[model samples]
Target chain A: MTPHLSITDQPVDVASALAAVQTDAAGAVNAFIGTVRNQSGGRPVRRLHYESYDSMALTQLGHVVAQAYEKWPMLQEVAVVHRKGTLELGDVAVVVAVATPHRAESFAACQFIIDTLKQVVTIWKREEYEDGTEWVAAHP
Target chain B: MSLKVALFGITRDIVGTSVIELPAPAPATVGELLAEMRKQYPALGELRSCAVAVNNEYATHDHPLRTTDEIALIPPVAGG
Candidate 1:
């Protein structure tokens, strides 16, 4: 099967992804990108490190697509990319793309994937500050 | 008796492992389990915004824990 979900540490290529989408068939394409921020809890961030239990993490990512398909029958395809390892501020951390016949369904599915990913997916990030480093626990 | 608890992200890195086993009579709730972990692993005490999931779902602090249940510690996500 063509895997619709992926988890990686490398940078994301949004244009290539957009180029691959079958725009002819997909009337709408909605994509969401997550990037590292400059601060967390008002503290300045130098960099961030992300880690996960690879196998289990992939399993949970697959579940997100399954849930999306179940909830939005019209959804055609989904592409998910998650980065791991050390990342500096302003780096891309995660990307979610959904294609459907309509814009509304694509938007809904993309939002659900990202919002729920924060709450469900087993990925963790640590914020490295100038003074020290701390792991972030929730999406803010 | 002991139960295995999987810590991830900051928790694992701080304690330095993916799985941790607690002494018998594991805490009844997820929150209590976290408290116990803090007492055992000093680094866990530094986390104030970590999230807990029972199996794969984002569970509440009141979520019950069992010897056989799968528990995961999810730190913040920065994926885009």
Candidate 2:
């Protein structure tokens, strides 16, 4: 099995993530890259600081991969890489890649991996603006 | 007995520490630990929702916590 899950403080490498999920049997590969937007909810963001419970996040990431496989049995491989720590605008923060025998399944699996990861993983991001900083999705 | 709970994100900021040591009774459930945490740091109550992870997996409120269990406070996640 390919290395399908990771959490890093460095920049997320989209190419490597796609490469990891590439296989000879796969006829289609889909990749999703999430970058730091310049603004959020009308406030200009200076940067983003991401944090995670490393071990727990990794374990949850593995579960996400397993879920993708369970949902799309045709998926040949999957890679999910989430970047932590400070990131400037336009920096790649996450990459999800999936390969399968067909395009539709690969795309669906990739989407499911990212969507499930955001819900279940123990990772958070703090949006820093010129005036102040706040943890995203923290308040009720 | 004392149990050390790992804190992250807003919980860490509210508690002002990455790891917190709480005086928990033996055979404590995750709900009990969270109650103690909220009592100590009431600011945690402001969160919309949070999950408790025991030994790297999401734990139910009634899940029993051992002294050696790796406990983590998972706040509302926003990672993509």
**Best model per lDDT:** 2
lDDT of 1 by residue, A44-140 (tens): 8998888866666777788877888899987777788888888887888887888889999988999998888776577777788999976565423
Q: For residues A29-91, what per-residue lDDT tens digits would candidate 2 score against the true structure?
A: 999899999999999999999998888889889888887778887889888889999999999
* DockQ of every candidate: 0.34, 0.89
Chain A TM-score vs. truth, each candidate: 0.90, 0.97
Give me candidate 1's TM-score against the actual structure. 0.73
Candidate 1 chain B worst ten-residue window by lDDT: B71-80
Each candidate's clash count: 8, 0
Comparing only chain B with the true structure, the TM-scores of all models are: 0.84, 0.92
Estimate every model's Cα lDDT from 0 to 1: 0.75, 0.88
Candidate No. with top DockQ: 2
Best candidate (score: TM-score): 2
